[model samples]
Target: MDLLINHFWELTITGLAIGAVYALVALGYTMVYGVLRLINFAHSEVFMWGSFAAVWALMAVGAGKASGLGLAGYLVIGFVAAMTVSALIAMLLERVAYRPLRKRNSPPLIALISAIGASFALSELMGLRDKPLGWFNLENLRDYLGRPRENLPLPLQIQTKAVFPVFNYDVTNIDLIVLLSAIVMMVILDQFIRRSRLGRGIRAVAMDPEAAALMGINRDRVIRLTFLIGGIMAGAAAMMYLLKIGVTRYNAGFILGVKAFTAAVLGGIGNIRGALLGGFVLGVAENYGSALFGSQWKDVVAFLLLVVILLFRPTGLLGESLGKARA
Candidate 1:
């Protein structure tokens, strides 16, 4: 308890940064689940690729220094690249893995299977890029994918220089950047879903597909848009993760994706605001639990919280359907 009280603000700032990542990733899961009622298990790859996209962007421009206008411009470049690539990949997944299944009116199980298969294929493809294509001298793959156990290097490192103090904790530039950027995204997304025309279409479809289709709302387009939005959010998260942790791998997204999925379920699967709420709460709780127990127990504490929450509030904290949500 003393450890917690003394380092409370430090832990809190850390949790919020991590929770922002989870929340961004969770938005992808929750939005898709909201409209399709099917979890896009392959969404992890979407996030992973986004992370790579940012790294690639920075690498292409050879970003190094962490401060000044040049670095800031490069950061924007990285984010834009990440979002573009992530959105494209997500759209690709929808077209290849999901579109055919949906057209065949396949069972939900089939879609789930397809998602898992796509995920594995993508992961292996990244992991083996050097293995399979190395014979062709196609640019050393070690620069990006490397061996399965090895992590890809991120050249740009955001120096965690303190800009302000939060009670006893010194808040850094990276902390504010991540938290504020995430909040901006969430606010925009919530407003879009609640007030925009296409967002209304999304809500309609989520509430009733047949009804939405009958009303001349193109279900296919809406579905694609949902995936795109989710992908974009995941891209934002990918950027933050790379900037904060400065390391990534082919399968990096798998665990984070699962945790984000749990955040979605914990907050009320189809609700946007619920995702935000669940992510922060879970992050804070996990940090506190780690303080109470030990650092190694943090992951255990997070998942355990999900189990406990589901046991008590089966529908989750907010429990509102996206269709009916005011966002």
Candidate 2:
């Protein structure tokens, strides 16, 4: 029983760490959905790009070398670079893919199709570029920007040679960093939406675009800002993801994006707080379910939870009709 309890706590911590990442990614999905009433399927790709960006940046800064300013410094530089690149890419994607569609006043179906196409195109680009990118060598920019050739070692290490503290819990430094960063980001986002002018614009547009425009809010600008914020969040998630699980490939975002999107729905689409809650719940549930039924059924468990939630509490735990209410 003691052994089981120990393992449970460890797994719980691991689950929360992962869940924090999911929550960050889910914020992008929920935010866009709330304001535009559209599911940005391509948001996952934004995350993928962010991860690649960080990997590349780390390599550029000689992160993998045995003698750099150490892992901590490398991580700081890598994260900032990755976030910047991801945000830019996300904004561009919005402009090229969704903005034009919105301008055309296209039907939601058409917009959805556009998102699918953009996702495929982006993924295919990564695939075609993957081979030339090389492995951990970091010679070319692609090598830096691409996924690792091999899987990163387990973030945790156990010390068998220690007499005093025999069982060392060596959680990955990156994981802790990622978890903390996510929390910081959430707080920043909360403040932005609650206290900033841009946030006010976002809320106003979310409530009623026509009214917002009537009040002199640039509807287009607000929409763009929404995409921008979402993109930045996705980028941050990407950095943590690569650090936690090193190998990156095209289409990586597809599965992750889907799960994050599910979380958004589970939390009641368009509710920021709901997204956070749903993400953590899903993460923990998935981890425990995998522990109980094996990894193969983990995804099945997540979907089952979604189904049960929708069937019973469609509005989610905290997602009431308060979407229109200012944060």
Candidate 3:
């Protein structure tokens, strides 16, 4: 108890930082589910790819010795690479995996299977990218991936500095960046959806595809935009993750994706604001649970809470449909 009390703010801030990433990814899930009524399990890979893009961009830009404002410039390049790559892949996934199904009017199970297959295929490609390159004896790109599970060393190391007081603990640069950036991203999305014409079309389609089309809203365009927006957020999360954690692996997004998905469901799958609420709540819960149990059991605690939440509040704490989101 004394230990928990002593480190209260530490745990909370850590949870919030991690949770912000989860929220960014969770927004992808929530937005897709809202528009399509289907879970894009492969969306996790979108995040995984974003991380790689950022790291690869770092290598390409050679940002090793950058400091002060130069570090910030390099960070922007990495972020842009992540977002562009993620958005492209997400759009491709929608075109190949989901669009075909939608055109054929396939069952939801079929789409789910397609998503799973795409997820596995993307992950394996990231893992065994070298094998294919070796087939052509192309050694350059092979070296880029390094290894399947090895940590991809970060180039620009952004030092953490205490900036503000939060309770009895000092909030560091990392915490401030993660939290504020996440909040800003979510707010922009919320405003876009609530106030913009394109956003209105998205909501209309989420409400009813047939009627939306009859009302002159292009369903295809809306769906693509949804995927693009979600992908961009995932990319942002990837850059933020790299900044905060300072390393990544081929499959790093897998576990984090699961946590983010839980966050989506915990907040009400289709509700935008709910994703934010869920992510923070889960993060704090995981931290507190880890303090009580052990660090090794954090995953257990996260999933257990998900199960408990579902059992009690099936629609989530802030229950609302995407069409009627209380954002």
lDDT of 1: 0.88
Off-target runs (Cα >4 Å) in candidate 1 are 140-149
Error of 3 at 49 (Å): 0.2
Question: Could you tell me the C-alpha RMSD of candidate 2 in Å?
Answer: 4.5
lDDT of each: 0.88, 0.75, 0.88
lDDT by residue (179-246, candidate 3, tens digit) is 88788888999999998999988888888889999999989999999999999999999988887888
User: Which is the better candidate, 1 or 3, if ranked by TM-score?
Assistant: 1
Model 1 earns a TM-score of 0.96
Q: Residue 47 in model 1: shift from native, Å? A: 0.3
lDDT of 2 by residue, 83-145 (tens): 787788778888999889899899999888888888888877766665554565545554333
Candidate 2 vs candidate 3, lDDT winner: 3
Evaluated at residue 249, the lDDT of candidate 2 is 70
What is candidate 2's TM-score against the reference? 0.86
For model 3, the stretches where C-alpha displacement exceeds 4 angstroms are 140-142
Which sequence of candidate numbers ranks them by TM-score, best first? Answer: 1, 3, 2
